[model samples]
Target: MTTPSRYVRSKTAALITFPFSGGQPRKGVELGPEALLRAELPKQLEQLGWGVQLDRSIDWDSINNLLTSDADINSLKNPRSVSKASEELANAIEKHARAGELPITLGGDHSLGTGSMIGLNRVYPDVATIWVDAHADINTAKTTPSGNLHGCPVSFALGLDGSYVEPFKSWLPNPPIASPNRVVFIGLRDVDEGERKILKEQNIKVFSMHHIDKYGIGKVVEMALDYINNGTSRRDRPIHLSFDVDALDPSVAPSTGTPVRGGLSFREGHYICEAIHETGSVVGMDLVEVNPLLESEAAAQTIAVGCSLIRSTLGKLSRLISGETLLD
Candidate 1:
């Protein structure tokens, strides 16, 4: 029998449900965590022999604060509320990581990435990130056309120029900085103009759809691992996989905040997670942007795929079925 890898350092996992939606202009995205939980995500993880610590008592009232469109950054919507939610999430994630448990964040939206990564980074300073998404999500407040905080998490986490908002900057001033060089992006097809310039200027590594089409998913992943690990064994470096369900083609994951055409295939999406799991270095993961109310017919499909992706990253499929024999 094959032994399970050491992805969860403490043999325990903390499931942090970030049921928040202040990052974007959407209401239904906040329902993602509940939908995923109702789908038996905690039980599924426990089936993989993990000691799951699920957070059932989420104080939405305490975490949320009143906000208006008026902030230091005028175009940025709900700036104070988004910052508050992110700060709270960061503290929760940090608590789990400090205890040596892997953090599995069921995100309310992509905006939660700011807090998730920040919290994980606090524990592991050298953490490498694999940002899997249809959009680069690196836009700053000034560059974001829609002023949605979801589109600007990457900037906030990286301490980019335009992310210095009032409330976010006050508390998360010295964010655990993940060097731009150590981060890699995959499945990006709809990056904004300013984000494109920032990507080039900062030399952030990216494997867009065109690159994926050329190199294939396997080679692309290999390249991503090599780049982030700096040619060291991937197992030696801590990994943070921030997976947005919209990274997959809308046909595969139709219920999301932003559905882009011509995205990663279902297999491609799973392949990314599976490869990362094989390294046994995934310290933190966030599955975000799953809007169950978007596509009625495809809601179940999207939720199932999201759950399966989580399973894939947690070393679920690395084992064979019971009573299976290898004909050697």
Candidate 2:
């Protein structure tokens, strides 16, 4: 019998349902977890030989109550709410990840990336991260045009320019969780001007749609993994995939808030998860920004894809395609 890898069990996914949308201006992203659950995402993973544990210890009401003040600190909306909840989320994810369980956090927004990575990095300090989104989501307080906290998670995780402020500064650690070298971004097409400058200055790795059109999904994902591992074997490091549904073209996942036109096809999106599962080093993942309040057919389509992608990450796609056995 093969032993399970160190990073995760053939482990249970501690399904953390974050019914939060305070990170941005949207109202329905907080409904993401319920939509995925109603679609039976947990049962689907069980069929793939993974256990599912719903994390109910988090008091989401209290977390939301903290947002009563509409005051923006340093131009960041819902500052206290996002900061306090993220700190709580960090604790929750750290508990599961440290126990060697894969924490598949259903996000309220990409801002949860700030908390999720902090949790995963606390366990695997050298963890590598792959961010799949239409926007770089790296704008700091100074660079953000809309002042949404969701757009600023990446900078907060890296301690980049304009991220050093209260609330975040109080809990977000020194030296931050993500080192610039260990991060990579894919499916980016809507990146802002300020964000482009940071990507250049920080020398981050990015595989935009232009690159994907040039090199194909397989090669782009391969290059992303190679770059994150610094050209070493990927098995030695832990990985966290933060996927925003907007990375899929609007047609593929039309229910998302920031749908982009040119995005990954269904096969291409699933293929990325397959590649990550093949590494067997994924410790945590986040599926964020799914709003089920949109068109009925479109919402259903987006939810189905979200469920499918989550299963792929848990090794279902690889088990089928490569004839690799999963679980005992």
Candidate 3:
């Protein structure tokens, strides 16, 4: 039995997997959640003393049923099904939050952010999110050139679709999880022309590669943490970290569904997570778009190491020796 404490307590971390591949044009991102598990992520976290709850499978059949009903020529994949799965995911995350447990979701794709963010919002209501990725995922169905749902999750979360009817409407009744001012994007480099316009007009805080190059990652992370944690004296709202694996340099994490050039170095990525851990307000996190099929054996090993770095974000590390400091 675990008891809650003041600063820290025995925490529960759930590894929730949704194997839906329809979000992206690519097929293998659905394998991401399982691939992380096969790499022994649970055991690693267990070594850090978190009580691990593994929701190995979600009902993809239920998602299929909803999608089939809402299928369209323009929207080839089922919006109804995707929304349904998101709702279920939301419910699960809400349950974990209410229990005072930390939830760490694995990727089915970036589209799953729709569900994960919704779930976090339901629990914390005033929650803020940190979006770390190579591209700005803010395209609507009309705006998306590829018609891939993965590219449109941020738009969906923000409720920006022109065809806001039926199943799609149920996904997000409100417009966006956090206000544009509240959200911060880091490590962006490969944005579409329209997305660049949307990001600029909305005044969303974007720390692009150029910004990082000028300001340094340490300063960028400091600004992000302060922005999210500001003005909360008593009970701070939760912070949801949506980390697209593609935010990392392709050389470091090449197994993603979309590999972009010029992303965060391995140390930079780990430092972001480590700094978030320092804040102690992170409630939920998602590591998305890791496509093992696109990887070689060496690439898979690299991703597995990267996943370990995420564990560090949740305060997972080897037990300290008697004389060793945490900083050591």
Candidate 4:
């Protein structure tokens, strides 16, 4: 039998979509939110018995009343815009989370994860986080070589070194939104030298492709869930899954800006979501970085795969229950 979510009071999913991509210097990534919507994301969730609360009431066009000018601070691009947008996204997520509705945020970039983690933490203060991506995304202001805020959202979420600096601190809560002990990463293959030291110094948990190859995806996920849950039970704490499309192999999902080679296969990616669904502890999820403009030829394929992954995360679709798949 499938395990029903303990957090949702009703079968309602807050389809929080944002098109702000000020975090990175990519024009196509901002179109991700609309791409997923055009793919009938709301209807797909409704088929799984969810109400699909599509709330676009927020005036995200103004960047949440930001005084942002295309200025860079501390080598960061669009710091004010990203901070204000993150604050707005965080507030929307917190509202839905407080209403006992599942918040499935469709993001403009992986930087949206900064909002996801911060907002969910407001409700579930002890929420466990699962970051799925090819990159570690733990780069700090001092560590970031490109100055793209997309690569530094994890640092912002954790309040790592240089995270408490200007613009972000004005809205961001005092760091450590979710405890470092409750955060974990999977599918990591490309990690910067600075990010490597940060991960090691902070004692964060990570399962790279090397680990996946050595112990298999199943064991890696099991260990990740256990660590986040403090080894008590996989369902012991609320979970927030931040999925970057780059985690999947370039062949499986090639529409992303930073496509890493030899990433998760179609089945491997779905397995992570399905496993989390089985726990019934996932309260929030963010599907980010599906840049359709980058790969026009394969954009349709990437969108289809992204939608399928979200479905697997939301319900018992790709896995067996009592010796039978849901479709069977």
Candidate 5:
């Protein structure tokens, strides 16, 4: 049996799948969690000796109705519904995190990260986040051209002015536990122009493709962890890894809603998760933006990659999943 530790020790993971896709224009991303489940994700985690608490699937009937409930908020699409769903997701994740179980939320879309992070902060107020994504996902409602909430999760999580927080005012108390310095980004390649200004203005630390090309993923992970942990032991802080599968090379993970080329290699992506696991401070995680409607074969590959990413975060070895003799 595993001994209780300061970070994670219960050997239990609360698997919460947000299978609704109102954050973007995509229709099939909601099916991502089911696809992952169909791939036996829970069984794979069980093989790693993790006792899984599978939460009930989200009831999307009411959520979908709320999507068109309000007029656009400064050109933002479905602001009301997205905020409601995020608030609900935050509550669900908060319950598991407070219980000391690693809360793993499968994708509805990346926008849900707002809720996931807020919920985690309620439990570990000092939690640090390593946002792995191809796009910045930090565009505010005013700056987003597509008006898709998926592209604006980081802004909402950071409590930016353009985010819809009034609806969640009663629930999300003292939100945005993550400050500019505490959060870092990896694998960013297609950042928007406005987001670039925000990144520079907020002094957000980002390791774009340029940085990755220079430093390598190993060094990048080390730097990211060091920044978040602030030279302290991992046990002294909680780590929240918000992984968007698009962070991987399109060839590596193509079934995502937004696939950017020249992303992390398959091994590099797993390396990020493995390194986080080694810290033993992982409190919660979100695997989002997986859309199976993109292409059947590519979707399957992306789903496999998504599952592999989650397995790595949960302390499973890469070879255990594919027998590939990659470095740890």
Candidate 6:
């Protein structure tokens, strides 16, 4: 018999759900992925002529339970379980990327970044990550006061120590997925004191609200693009974008578990996503930490619309129709 084709056509986008919510002290983020899906995200993309493949069978609950049981009572909520869930998520995302599909991940929480980045790194060793959030998320276990793993994913993904125990070593890779230079943080306003030291010490590029205020979104994005795309030999180095809903102002997305004030405006957030899409190298993305329980149904609907708008920045609903701009 003839061998089956090794490469399936990748015209469809893969929606991978990660529903674990143990990253922070809250419990509602576990429902984020499902809520976004129910918001008719697939139909929206379908309207733009892209096929949608929903992969929602992830065992987020089991992962959450495992982490909660193994967690240190005082330090963090669920360290081991978060790491375990990340490992599983990494495997799935890696599989999809290797198959040449665009992997769009729905987060259980921001900690999912550890697993998601690991998976992307396995497929594209030289990949870079663009972290869009209100907090730096670079704090390690030694620096974190809240013990929220969500604030430590960047550290963990870079192989820095956090709340993880000895038994969870295998869940994280040795060198992690990204280097300090390869990662860029944008839209930050609320930064912990320890996180500030680590960021300055590592010389990690951070464009905080002050920077945005000085340079404007367009200029900031231009600088960010240059920073992330600099010195790469390959024409297309794989890009993984980690988007926390809290990156937007609480006025825009109040349903996030950790809403920070003085964040990016809706247009600013969309501009970031659009600029990244313009790079033509984005292969994976994550929408994280949206909590429906924190808001009314109407508010959740608004947040859902914002999610759709962000997805559009990735060309989710964009079409190549003939049109003239106002300038034209």
The lDDT leader among the candidates is 2
lDDT-wise, the better of 2 and 3 is: 2
Q: Pairing residues by index, what is the TM-score of model 6? A: 0.89
Which parts of model 2 have CA positions greater than 4 angstroms off? 1-5, 322-328
Of 2 and 4, the candidate ahead on TM-score is 2
Over the full model, what C-alpha lDDT does candidate 5 score relative to the true structure? 0.82
TM-scores of all candidate predictions against the true structure: 0.92, 0.95, 0.88, 0.94, 0.92, 0.89
Clashing residue pairs in all predictions, respectively, total 0, 0, 3, 0, 0, 2
Higher-lDDT candidate of 3 and 5 = 5
The C-alpha lDDT values of all candidates are 0.83, 0.86, 0.73, 0.83, 0.82, 0.75
Q: State residue 322's C-alpha deviation in candidate 4, in Å.
A: 8.1
In TM-score terms, candidate 3 sits at 0.88
Predicted candidate 6 versus true structure: per-residue lDDT over 1-328, tens digit per residue = 1101122236567889888777787888878788888878877666555578888656766765676567475566577777778778888888888888777888768988888877888888878888999989888888888887888888877876553444446666765554656788899999999999989887899999899999999988778777776744332555788899888888888888777799898788878877676566777889888887775864585457556654554464233322211110
Tens digits of per-residue lDDT, candidate 1, 14-49, equal 888888887887778888988999989888877776
Model 4 stretches astray by more than 4 angstroms? 1-4, 64-68, 318-328
RMSD of each: 3.0, 2.3, 3.4, 2.4, 3.0, 4.8
Give the alpha carbon lDDT tens digit for every residue of 1-328 in model 5. 4512257657888889898788888799989998999989998887776898998645567888887565676677887788888888888988888787888999889989889888888888888888999988998866888888899888878877566455545555555454756679999999899899988888888999888899988988888887777654344468889999999998999888778899999999999999888777788899998899888999999999899898888767734555543422
Q: Which lDDT value does model 3 have at 216? A: 93
Q: Which residue runs of candidate 3 sit more than 4 Å off their true CA positions?
A: 1-10, 64-70, 73-76, 161-165, 230-237, 317-328
Ranking of candidates on lDDT, top first:
2, 4, 1, 5, 6, 3
- Any idea what lDDT model 2 has? 0.86
lDDT of 4 by residue, 101-126 (tens): 88888878888888889999999898
With candidate 3 superimposed using the best TM-score fit, by how many Å does residue 219's alpha carbon deviate from the native?
0.3
Candidate 6 at residue 195, lDDT?
A: 96
lDDT of 5 at 289: 85
After superposition, the stretches of candidate 1 with alpha carbons farther than 4 Å from their true spots are: 1-7, 56-58, 65-72, 175-178, 321-328
lDDT of 4 at 311: 83
lDDT for 93 in candidate 6 is: 89
Residue 321 lDDT, candidate 4, scale 0-100: 50
Off by over 4 Å in 5: 3-5, 68-70, 164-170, 174-178, 231-235, 318-328
Cα lDDT for residue 283, candidate 4: 90
